[model samples]
Target: MDSDVDESLDIIITNVVATFRTRCHLNLRTIALKGINVIYKPEVGKVLMKIRKPNISASIWSSGKIICTGAASENDAKVGARRLARYLQKLGFKVSFSDFKVVNVLAVCSMPFAIHLIDFTKNNRSIASYEPELHPAATYRIKHLKATIQVFSTGSITITGPNVQNVAAAVETIYPLLFECKKFLGK
Candidate 1:
């Protein structure tokens, strides 16, 4: 019975993820670039990126606020945010970034909300250590590295005290990686 229940849950989650992917496919593909980096700065709860070519830059602050510094237009900035949010979701990270708020479509379009999480495991141990409190309509768990990455689908991610700091620090440390991706995209 337990196994059956677990299997059912898996199927449900898979279906939800698939639906999200399909809905967002077009926008995601259109804005998908070859190179991009995601940096974590836990101290400030911020993630910053430096993109070349088109010279795009942006940041996700701990307060659940997203800012675009070098986008060509408001549309560009929104698209960048949506792409980042979607990619994070695909990677198994729970994201609260709102697609409707960030993405503005002139015509009728469908954008699915999705989040993915990848657990870090090695040496017979998991890395994620933080456990966040339960929130409505959000799902999360701890992975490897004492790092717990939680994402929200309602366009707002809630972070507590220490976890917020950790996220910010991680974003800063990983900024360079995002730049490398940008370079690869030739943008």
Candidate 2:
């Protein structure tokens, strides 16, 4: 494909999952009471919190580990994680933000044409699997990039990877194969 086609294919990041640790333990009960927009589950021993600025949701464990999700970008994920730690600090916890890292990124991209799902999966059986009974989309795995792509018959693909670069690479790598099985409309 030409560079124009490649450039036109845009990868839209939908969610970013990040994780961080506080140096000290967190009191779930205190956070559930003192924190805003929090849901405390005593049975699970964890707290769920939401922040609006970066549009993130956090899962807080008493062990000082926090997992933040729903951010649209890596920077947003980091910012959201920091905000979570700050919230803990405001709650009277001697919190130290450490080991902050973006664990996973979810993105979507649409192809120019629809795909023949069965044909595509059969051609790439080693890396692709399609079980309509189990799920609508076919799952394709790229071992080297550690990325998983869910390809739909309607030309929409959902990709998840460790980072943005890998996710973009996975799309580029699969575009040619998808093109080969493109369904010709009105045929």
Candidate 3:
């Protein structure tokens, strides 16, 4: 039954956001001028750097904090962060890679059946909030997993959690509640 559920749910990780520190100050202006595929936004006080291998984008701050997003997996996120730090090292900064952490993971999965959003919200009012006017999807949060699951009428779910394990656990935790509100196709 667990295998069946896992096969059906098919959670696909779409994005992983991770952050790391260089442990040294970075000169944004110089990086923008010398770095490849870099965009320096002075107003935002960060430089955006893009790498092709892992297809990730990183926001680098002068304070030496870098946030990497768009990685498909946690390992990719770590690799992307390391690559970004190496780029800074080549630019003459005393870059020391430390404090690398995966802060958020976003995944998408589709239920085998359509979801009755209103019914689901009604059944789990305390944890689920539905506002059709403001958003099309009902937002549900799992406190223990520290994950947020967004359910749409089309049976698509978007999950954001601290890590991949938590995201997957959240799907399992919410499945029964969602099954109760599953739409019946036949009249």
Model 2 segments more than 4 A misplaced? 1-7
lDDT against the true structure, per candidate, is 0.34, 0.94, 0.93
Weakest 10 consecutive residues of candidate 3 by summed lDDT: 1-10
Per-residue lDDT of model 3, residues 1-187, tens digit only: 3453555678999999999999999999999999999998999899999999798999999999999999999999999899888889999999999999999999999988798999999999999999999999999999989999999998899999999999999999989888888888884
User: C-alpha displacement of 102 in model 3, angstroms?
Assistant: 0.7
> After aligning candidate 1 to the native by TM-score, how far in Å is the CA of 33 from where it should be?
20
What TM-scores do the predictions have? 0.29, 0.95, 0.95
**For model 2, what is the error of residue 70's alpha carbon versus the real structure, in angstroms, after optimal superposition?**
0.6
> Model 1 over residues 103-186: C-alpha lDDT tens digits?
211111111222211121111133322233544323222332233333333222322112223433433332232222221122
Clashes of 3: 0
Candidate 2: residue pairs that collide: none
Model 1 misplaced regions, further than 4 Å: 1-36, 51-55, 96-187
